[model samples]
Target: MKEYKRFLLYGLVVGTVIGFYLIFNLKSFVSYENIFIDKTDFMLSSRLIIYNKTCGLQHWKEKKNFGHRDDIPFFSILSTILSSTEKKIIIIEFGANVGQFSERVLSIPHKIPYIVHSIEPVLTLFHLLRNRSRTFKKEKNDKHFHYNLAISDQSGEKPIYSPSQYGEGSTLGKAFLSNFKEIENVTVTTLPEFIKKYHIKTPISFIKIDVEGFEPEVIRGMNLSINAKIFPLFSFETGETWLDDRSVLAKEYTLKSFVEMLNYFQYDSYFIGNPYLLPISGTYWKNSFDGLRRNPNVLAILRHSQPWKNLKKLLNRIPFTSC
Candidate 1:
């Protein structure tokens, strides 16, 4: 009996050590905050496991807090757009899932007049976003416009492939079809068309694109020639394995083409986040795309962009890594 008790005590000690080791290693996976929580993901997972017994549906939950931890630093970079512009700023956000980032933008303490055009195509997510934006406290002159449409190269109904577990995975890219199990038809709009339709005259300050692998389509929708005077800062998601040939959009569309398009439109590329924005050389961009150090997001700057000038001075004062 004593020997059995001794074995049990040793097993307990080993289990405790293993648990702590796992927790320490897992901490590296979560960026920014020590805690990771996605209300929608948790709700959907619970629903699937406890009630539905299926994980084929993605539903929306009210965005009560900043859903992503990374947004804290990302928004700080985003605020530079407003600081650079003397005129009232307008922010256009594509793929605004549940308005978490928009909420962060709205919460920033600033007296500058600003408006947010939050676009989310998914019906369920759009509903949650609309609700959240309505209740958010806005500064005097701060306004928000919610659009239930997808920003793409064309304006029409498009089949957005969505995974049951993560609605944010929904995309207009045909290449992403394999990752998603369900098809959702969403109304699509071009940026130029949206501006015209709404008669938005505010000086566009920034645009954030998170349309999964279909980012090239969003870039195509804009009329850069006329908007060059506004010269808004552009930040967007560059998906993992951007060079993967299996991606439906990637088969025909390459990351190089996307970068070249921005270059043709008079925009320079930079790697942003990590509190400092680093200018990405053509070789570095290519190497990054080829999988040296995968960056989830990149920023585009115009030659005359006032923000880039101030951003350099501001970033230099802080200590940060090139993430």
Candidate 2:
């Protein structure tokens, strides 16, 4: 009996040691805050915080706090591409899941002059976003418009699966066909109709899209020539696989497709992260599970053929040439 007890005690000690070792070594992967705070000196101070509290653990919650300086990189890059004569800057965001990114933009300093238009299709998410935006305190000059519709190649309604935050939320937008088998109708809109209905004037600035597997449709619907004259950047989320659905296409939607689409529009683009090393490309397959299991998101910049020529002579002092 004593020998058995000793063995049990030894096992407990070993388990404790292993747990502590894991906590120490894998601490960085536990949260973005730990990684960011350790790597940079920047600070964020904003009320809109995303708390992954679907689970009960406190430390397990991942939080993102936005602040003024956070907008510096985005603003500087954008301002360099746009002319000062441009009076109004319009930002169009599709599939704004719950306004998390939108709230981050709204918190930026001296950002009141721009107008934001966000489109979200899921009913539950739309309500959450509307509530959050309506309650959020902001300057009167900053205008925000929300449309509870999905943008696709064609105009019609289709059922979408609005899953609970805990139960495979990653597959929320993709499983629209299977999950909503009974409900065969859902509201969807095309980009052209939205632009016409919104009465968007020329000289647009940015377009961010995050729609789940329907990116190709969204891109096709837009008039690239009109966009080039106005919008300068397109930041979007891309994935290699479409969630199991009827609309799934043959070519897995990927960063390569994003490049091809932009090239078709005559836009030169670069990726934020090394696509070759990303999980989809199979370079980092071992860590693929931990990588972006959902679609990997990227930012694509579109510049005029000769943006430098459009810039004022004095503005040449600023670094406006390269990305």
Candidate 3:
């Protein structure tokens, strides 16, 4: 009986030592690295915060945050495809708006490291975006970068307005606002200047802009980079009418003008129809006020570029009815 008792005490002592060793040294093998809360994979030992706000993705009377319906599946596939062909997969999204779309892109697992630079002009939204990016925690070369300044044709400040802190219908004009919150004198910089300031010399895989009818200024501002072929594909949101931003510029750009610019740059515009990217004809402007008629998400890809060629083959991979 004494010998048995001695053997049990030894077993207990060994177990205690093993537990202590694991407690002190487990971090070496196990990753306690900070990561944003992705649906499937996340490390939780230590992280400042997780950016879980759905950015109005929550359906009415429904509990699930379905995520940005059209974006996630498409961009995820786009990133996956482009990562195979491009060395540094850099994606820049303007008007990132609280990092909602950015989260959708960054959360998904990628074959290789990719970079997303989110640009938000609204100060409050920018801060929220910065916080969300902080928890994303750089993984090797893959990272999320955010900027607070608006990009335009020149350096200056502009009055930016929004319906709420969540940033819907954020525009430079108060014409569309009903009980809107306005921020006076938000700083603005040209896109090329911004790229130079950040020393971003790499070619961009994709670009996105949602400046609420400010595409004229944005397109002009990005012309130098466009000419330089820094980005192969870009997407932007359009206003209700072909010419809504009359108050925005010394010269407002009509939908026809926007189309002209695309042709000028050898880019073809298409409307995102869930899994499909339907080409927009030059006469699409005459159909309705909404840009590309009812289609708001405009994808412009450099003509015959590898990204454009690759996208043609990837449409079948995107789920048709997810959105």
Any residue pairs clashing in model 2, and if so which?
Answer: 157-186, 158-186
Q: For model 1, how does the per-residue alpha-carbon lDDT over 1-323 read when each residue is reduced to its tens digit?
A: 99999999999999999989868754422432312233476534211101110110111011221122343466765586553345677788898999888888888788787788899988888889999888887898898999888887778887766765446667665553466655578888888888889987745688888876667667766767777656457777765534443244444655566667677777777545344344453543444343312435667777556765555334323332222
- Residues forming the 10-long window of minimal summed lDDT in candidate 1: 51-60
lDDT of 3 at 154: 78
Provide the overall lDDT of each model, using Cα atoms, as 2-decimal numbers: 0.63, 0.51, 0.61
Minimum summed lDDT over a 10-residue window in model 2 is located at 275-284
Clashes of each: 1, 2, 0
Candidate 1's TM-score reads 0.68
The better candidate by TM-score, 2 or 3, is: 3
lDDT of 3 by residue, 201-261 (tens): 5567778877766766777788744463666778776645234433365235655566666
Q: Which regions of candidate 3 are displaced past 4 Å?
A: 1-69, 81-86, 137-140, 165-168, 175-181, 224-228, 241-243, 246-257, 282-295, 315-323
Residue 179, model 3: lDDT of 69
What's the C-alpha lDDT at position 320 in model 1?
Answer: 29
Find the candidate with the highest lDDT and give its number.
1
Superposed Cα deviation of residue 290, candidate 3 (Å): 5.4
lDDT per residue as tens, model 2, 104-183: 66666554366778888766677788888886555557778888787877787765553344222222244334443232
